[model samples]
Target: MMISLSRACVLTAACTVVLTACGGSTGTGGSATPTSSVDVGKASAVTPLDSATIARAEKQGSVLLYTNADAEQMAPVTKAFEAKYSAIDVRVLNMTDPQTFQRYATETATGVRTADVVMATDAVGMLNFVSKGNVLDYSDPNLKNLPDYARLAPGVVAMSEDPVVAVYNTALIPKDKQPKDLKSLAELSKSIKGKVGTTDITNPMSFGSVSNYTAKHGDAGWKNLEVLGQNSGVESGNGNLMQKLAQGQYQAAYFVAGSVRALIEGEEAAKVLNYTYLTDGTPMLPRAVAVTKKASSPDAAKVFVNFLLSAEGQEAACAGGFTPYRDGVECAYGLPAVEAVVGADNMMLGGYLEGIVKNKPEIVTRWKSAYDR
Candidate 1:
């Protein structure tokens, strides 16, 4: 109930409005029935589905997935599943994070549930789905392998830890001299002057993660960004930023993790371009996945979600350049595991939900003010 009011207030800019009669299913126990809103954040323990459930899911014939992840990155997982299951077809719909959530919400409200599974980078929006009782719980045995932060609430799990990174051209800045923290990055930017490149501040992935720096460290983090913003080349997207950096047009680029993943893990450019997680800590935008409350193929959703959180699926993800959530899963491009790169104290998952998402407009305004100065 509070979640609905909060979202309404944020979107409509209305103050102190009371919510009347929001509807949805209750928590994990007896999940198929609808009820009024409850404290959805409370954690509910779960167990693996029984053999009968698996048999029923196999009969469901198809599983529909809606996600924000690139189709190429998800293809391997789907292919592996098809090879094993052989009967149930996997249908994927690629949409923006907002589109994915809105479509699920619309379908749920109208009593027509199409998405059995959903994966998206909009952690805050995904949490909203949990708060509204839209998520269904499938407590797989693999949940034991994941870090606590990955399971924010009952029925929700983080699919990947997509950390922000700085990419540099090895020909210009050598591997050993790369910036390890924000302070060093600021110094490197000053040294390079106009040779520093950055993704556009207007991009959600860039702005959202950088907002963590601003929220967590306050003045110091903003000061680092302010220092780096001077005379730096700004590209509208990370791909362009990385391209310019690799071409020797820029010595370094800031906050382009996905593009850096391609350079390091997908292409032969790893020799020319290398990426680093900040010594202080990189902001992780976890791509969260969940089963819908009214999934037509509930068992298939459980099976797929379990596979994604499994060792084999995580290994495939690492091979494709995404950071796996489970401990001991091999890191992409031989980089250090997530635990080594991001300390518990340095993580921004809670900070993002508590501070950044609700006050995004003000943060963007502050960021613009600092950058323009």
Candidate 2:
């Protein structure tokens, strides 16, 4: 569930609507990009998406995408998808998760239907759409092929497996000294107080950060995050957080795993960076997509969703450096295998996330006070 940034060009002729969106990408799959052609340091970097299916996807008329994955990386695939489905179009509005959800919720609430498709990091956000009757329900004929976990919503499905990875400047910390788990990350926060980078506590971090928050110190886990923030010495919006980490501005950043890997090997950060998983908060986020409840082209939308979950599309996504959400599309990129298939994939945090809507004032109040500390 990575790689969502894109230029206006990323939005194909399919839709006139413009909105912000975010998703993630890592370990080469249907994408072939180092985002701007900057020389990533590794020769064996993550695989790009499968060239064949991507070639087909580019031709599928115009499909608007709201994701966190890199738009630059998606450009080739977008071009290819449009080419294959000449009648279709593809557009990726690349905005941060917060901005994406904000705009989507705002527009959808006001009866301003702007997006036809969304590939988002927060399944909870998707639930927002579904609950509001903004999302359409149409079980893809291909749903039978997916394991139950992939079929999260009545109509929605997972597109990728993206770990919320923590990255650091390898040059700053020796590999032997790198934190291997969340416990170590907390310790490292103390050990290198000024070197750590964190998401703005007032803003909340990645979905994975939710797990980190709870696992941190119980009901007062958010309080521990404040401590971590103090040690962080730097706070930025989640979207730009990783780019700064890639630039070595900070020793470590908490962001999606696959995106950081591209930066680790794609630029000057390579020689100095390393990433690891937290032993406790281990599961990755799932980026998902679904048709609009008011879809002008329901059939086309279903076709696109089916394409995304297909073996070809899933594998291409995997090759493009992101994990495929469908069953059995494994990669050689060293990502952990899908263990004990999760029963019903759910990424959108439940009622807790309602703060973004229902209790924004209080949520913002608490968040600001935390950062103010």
Candidate 3:
């Protein structure tokens, strides 16, 4: 059974594919080494990050948010925030997961950052900071009402409903070609051998679902991956995947909710690719949020992360196609059931990702070489 993300599992807000050989070993438990000379924890700054800091940082009302979300969705979210706190100036900078992490780590070490809120699904970063005590333990009042999966201790939290979703260029693949279930999808892989594309281990989290699926179904679950591994066109990130799909460079791609929704809604991509929800099952969460160390607007950041995990955020997630990690979030968007596949009692989806970092590569590599044979 897929573990229930709420209650017990340590939730990760973002997944990164572009990895560096940082001090820590790579895996679910590995953390980024402290490369800076100063102790980030005791290193005090000007003052506490409270309303006063927010007011000052606002410059009467200006705040910058660094996000991995596509511009279209973020634009409106930014506008909503500005409308609520007119004194807050919000500027959002978009980057891939890798760029986002590198920039944050650099900025944190340098003692300067443009990001008031660092939003992402990169769990490695979230865990790195949270475990190292880089995060502030401030909790939002509304947080208690949130579902369990959305909780990432008292610190990092995901504020958006970014689910990893499957997408197809409507112009290229026929509807009949799409898999109706995880089992069927694996079977279908044999038919369309070279037409699929996805991220690799470098992506760790997003494609980690493959490993998660394997744990549940054993060899049966991995059958689908045997097909994915054989694909002729594999990419490192979802943004690239969407762009390629938009241009008709590839017929189908698995995606995070942000990239899919961002592109499909933008005038640039809506004309080309359509998100095809796998009748096979809902994809694992492809996105999440984390508070950076030395943030300029810690309270507001706390508020924002809390909002994403609240009932409001989870419902919004269900409506948008991303599964809500928090509890009581019914998939009211007429979306498919993202019910746990492994067992009914389980609540989290992170183990499979960890498993991949630990074991799946050998299997995937052997599986990949089979096509050559």
Q: Per-prediction RMSD in angstroms?
A: 15.4, 10.7, 14.1
Best by TM-score: 1
Taking the tens digit of each residue's C-alpha lDDT, what string does model 3 give over 200-232? 544644444554455556676565666666753
Superposed on all Cα atoms, model 3 deviates from the true structure by an RMSD in Å of: 14.1
Q: Stretches of candidate 3 above 4 Å error? A: 1-61, 243-249, 255-272, 307-373
Q: Scored by CA lDDT, what does every candidate get?
A: 0.64, 0.52, 0.48
Ranking by TM-score: 1, 2, 3
Worst 10 residues of 3 by lDDT: 7-16
Candidate 1, 66: how far from true, in Å?
Answer: 1.9
**Residue lDDT tens for model 1, 1-373:** 0001111222222112222221121111211111113221222233345777668878997899997665666677788777767877889887766677788878877988579998876556776777888788766676775567777567888767777777666667766677767778888787788898876656667676677777778888888888987757877666566656756788887776542454342233544556666657567776678888889898898888877777666667765556665545554422233334555566565423564447777877876775673
**Clashes per model (N, Cα, C within 3 A):** 1, 78, 34
Q: Give per-model TM-scores.
A: 0.75, 0.68, 0.66
Clashing pairs in 1: 180-279
Candidate 1, residue 288: how far the Cα is off, in Å: 0.3
Candidate 3's displacement at residue 121, Å, is 1.3
Query: Model 1, residue 10: displacement in angstroms?
Result: 38
